[model samples]
Target: MLKLLIAVIFFAILLSLAAGAGFLIRDQSPSTRLLTSLKTRILLTALLMVLLVYGFSQGALGT
Candidate 1:
């Protein structure tokens, strides 16, 4: 359980870092910058949440 939580935390951090890189490194099209940023944030948040849920449900970790 502790391990799973740790893993999830690490994964979330990695995802956010990658998203930050994407925002920092890419030249987004003017038409899509705002949308892309919003999408990235949403996906990051959702991915973390899903990981948490799955880990907990699978008994890999306690919520």
Candidate 2:
């Protein structure tokens, strides 16, 4: 269940990144949406890293 949740969150972050790139290409000027996406991605990445570490420590990620 935890792994599934982590995968979903990671996929969402990737989708957000793709959307932000699309916005950057379509818009004439820089927008807050892109920055917001970037910040979100960064935060999500950090969270994911923590989750990975915790999972490893708990022996949930390795055989």
Candidate 2 Cα errors over 4 Å, as ranges: none
Model 1 error, position 39 (Å): 0.6
For all predicted structures, in order, the TM-scores are 0.47, 0.89
Question: Which 10 consecutive positions of candidate 1 have the poorest summed lDDT?
Answer: 27-36
lDDT tens digits, residues 1-63, model 2? 779978988998899899889878887875688888888899888988998899889988879
Per-residue CA lDDT of model 1 for 6-30, tens digit only, reads: 5676676676667666766675655
In terms of TM-score, the best-performing candidate is 2
Would you list the C-alpha lDDT of every candidate in the order shown?
A: 0.67, 0.87
Question: Model 2: how large is the Cα RMSD against the reference?
Answer: 1.1
Which regions in candidate 1 have their CA more than 4 angstroms from the true location? 1-31
Give the CA lDDT, 0 to 100, for residue 48 in model 1.
Answer: 66
RMSD to truth, every model: 4.9, 1.1
